[model samples]
Target: MDTCCAKALVTGKVQGVGFRRAAQEQALKAGITGHAINLADGRVEVLMCGERTAVKRLAEWLRTGPGAARVTHVEFEVIEAHAPDDFHTG
Candidate 1:
């Protein structure tokens, strides 16, 4: 049960479509903690921290967000950060 962190930038019809909320739901389900925020460049930035498998799953899910989202691309990268106690959107 290795723990890790991953940051992903999701583009295309992501914002204003409940992407962050959906991500939070998925993160909770996976026992992950972090945040999903809307970037000024019209992308959704998702930060996931938890088990390696859960992080990977959340990252993969970002590729095809909620039904309202039209994800065109996702840029993922592992990083170092202090994880929060629960998932959030900002």
Candidate 2:
């Protein structure tokens, strides 16, 4: 399983919607490392690195967000892998 890294910015109805927790769960399930944080501007930022397939699956899940989330946009970019120590919510 090849590895890949990505930095994603999710916007629209993201904050205060359990988005961070969902991200943490997904990352953990996928054996990925990174953190999800809510920015002051009401957007969510996620930095994740893991097996390519796992990360891609996680990214797809992020597109829809959690059951309570109203995701409107997800902007993501793939980058060089910098495997982090763990997955967390910030």
Candidate 3:
């Protein structure tokens, strides 16, 4: 399958709201590989690597994360990186 990598900076009430974990679950369900990590600037950095469609789908989801997340904005960009074997959260 054709695969690629993408990065997103999620902002607004994402931290401490199970955003990373939720993202991990979503990524795993989609068969995507990457990670969701917290930034000191209060933004969640999500890297998705997999089929283009799946990556885009995950990016869209970041717009409105878990019920507890008040996702105000999600900045996305295409990137190049090695895909990991599984999804992760940090």
Q: Candidate 2: worst 10 consecutive residues by lDDT?
A: 79-88
TM-score of structure candidate 1: 0.87
- 1-90 per-residue lDDT for model 3 (tens digits): 778899999999999999999999999999999899999999999999998898889889999999999998889889976547897899
Q: What Cα-based lDDT does every candidate model obtain?
A: 0.93, 0.91, 0.93
**Against the true structure, what is each candidate's TM-score?**
0.87, 0.87, 0.86
Per-candidate total of colliding backbone pairs = 0, 0, 0
Q: Write the per-residue lDDT of candidate 1 for residues 1-90, one digit (tens) a residue.
A: 689998899999999999999999999999999999999999999989999998988888999999999999999888975547897899
- Model 3: how far residue 38 lies from native, Å: 0.4
Which candidate order results from sorting by lDDT in descending order?
Answer: 3, 1, 2
**Candidate 2's residue-wise lDDT over 9-89, tens digit each?**
999889988999999999998899999999999999999898999999989998999999988999999988655789789
